[model samples]
Target: MNDKTEELRDIFTDVTDGEETVTESQEDTRGSLERDERSTEERLESVVQQMRERYGFDDVSLSDDELITVAKSFYEGDSDAEIADALGVEPETVFEARMALHLVDEDDADEVDLAAIRNREEDDATLADEYDVDETQIRRYRRIAAAEDESRTANDRYRDEFDSVLADSELSERMTTDVREDGLEDATEGMETDVEF
Candidate 1:
């Protein structure tokens, strides 16, 4: 009995050590993964937020994660029927998401370049006709595009403001002089009075 126990213990120890080596390899691979590559769930969350804001689709009924999975599968060249069957949803739902996200062409599983459409600044009705998707989908895409544009504009404005502040040598010198002579509170008051918010 003692010999059998010792043999089992040795086997368990060997397995444990082997698992640690595999874990180390997995960690290395994990570290090598691209940080910019977002997971499907994260992508779904962003999509859901956009949809909610655009169309007030607060009760979309379907799982956002599952929708993203379907979208990814469709983008990977799977047919709507295939995704529907795999996910146990209606084929139309798959088709709708695929169209809304501009993953593929309306009648075919071929990839569509949504960026090109945005660059053209086509109207929603025109885009709906061109994409052969519903007008609602076109509207959703337009809303998302507008939101992204606003975000980009705000970012550009902030960058310009930051650059302007950094380039203002007179303001920098004044701040330095005031801070040295009048301390931080007085310097900040002077700045508030001199500089517009």
Candidate 2:
């Protein structure tokens, strides 16, 4: 050993009363390990329960399992019609359920002015006539706009939880990479050079 090595050895031995061997006791990790053993479905159910309790979604017609299905399908980028098919419900029902769960799509409230609707004193029928939209459409848009406002106040915590439950980061990254590579290949399909570098 070099001088520095020998000096370190001497210091270590002096600190250890000339002992040459050291042992360390690891912390008990069984509890933490066991906690992580829950199935994905169970974890999702737990999060759904927490959401229900936190938001008191008493008016929602969807059951716990249906709500989870909606959230999972939504995060997976399914359309309302597709989600409705999965749940054996109409698309309008799914829309209402999404509003109840604070899952408003960006375009759901885009057809009319949400600020105008919020400030107006007219009923749904009157607003629908004034906006030249269907009465149900007016109601749906108003509810979606309200949910969006509420979600903004809550920092979109519920949506984040919904995303985390089904949107695997690794899978998303891999899909993104694959899509980018495919696009690049398509863009360069006829650009190959005849001369070698």
Candidate 3:
């Protein structure tokens, strides 16, 4: 018999007498693992292809190292404080590029979330809910949620901190007054009128 056949026989012989032979399962497991590996590599390659296409880069010519360096410098500078500072570009540019190219590491987001939850504990007064996770977990989720908010700001935390949203949202004075003409008028406090009749 060939080497593979011999190895297979040996594997079968080594199986416990009480258990049925699982030769088919072994083969299936190996096949599934190989398939998963191939799929992961294909995803990475697809991301590389998209970055090359969108940014007008020649895949063979412009290496990821060069692009990452330029992007990092643009988004977060080389020095400690300078990291997030660039001459003419906002950090969002690099964030957008990294997201578009799928180059940013996913693990970082999880870590950031963990840190945020730890820092966002109650003012040493409220009790932790049993239904809720621990302080560490809550901090992590908050950090991650904040990062996601930076990308998509429809959440309450994303709303303006100092400015009154009601005041800003009201376009016309009459409109504000019509709503507030009832008890709802309290909602439009400090909304100045510039409407010309």
Candidate 4:
């Protein structure tokens, strides 16, 4: 073969070697990452279990990693709305967390329940009063009172959308909205009377 043919063959061989190297490196990276993720998930599950046992809120508990993940979302300058958007949860959840978690003296896990609840109630009362609310919500803290918090925001909508997709599009089938828009035409017909001079 001529010299040029030999040079081309050499370059092709190098390219093949580079491609194989990249593929192998990618496989190795993915394997290590999956192993680490499995371990993290197991640890997170354990933390939530412990929290449930301690708090008797078996219906409600926060994993250490999950709490940290939520905290990181806010510490990184995420508004409650933004954090709710990122975490695929309701905005009220984000606010409840931002308010309650701040009371967590992580240095002392024993103080978490007592301090967090008391502090959250105080803060909620202050916020409710500012908005001229009766502060009744501040008195009786109910979990997941959708009726009380009918104004579920965009973040909740996003989570509902995600959940709907995951449930094979059955999420909204379980929910019934108070208002149904037959169409814009019908909704505006009542207010369309002439008001001109």
Candidate models: Cα lDDT each: 0.55, 0.77, 0.41, 0.44
- Sorted by lDDT (best first), the order is 2, 1, 4, 3
RMSD per model, one decimal? 23.1, 9.6, 30.5, 19.2
Query: Per-residue lDDT of 33-67 in model 4, one digit per residue for the tens?
Result: 12223333354345434433444432323445555
2 or 3, which is superior by TM-score?
Answer: 2
- Residue-wise lDDT of candidate 2 within 59-101, one digit each (tens)? 6778889987887787778989999999998887777678766
**Higher-lDDT candidate among 1 and 4?**
1
TM-score of 2: 0.63
Q: Which whole-number lDDT from 0 to 100 does residue 126 have in model 4? A: 77
| Residue pairs clashing, model 2 | none
Order of models, best TM-score first: 2, 1, 4, 3
TM-score (all chains, Cα) for each model: 0.34, 0.63, 0.21, 0.28
Please name the candidate that would achieve the greatest lDDT relative to the true structure: 2
Off by over 4 Å in 2: 1-24, 27-39, 169-197
Off by over 4 Å in 4: 1-50, 58-65, 98-131, 136-197
lDDT of 1 by residue, 41-153 (tens): 56456755565465453334457677667655754568878888988988767765544443433444223444556566667788788888878776655544543454464
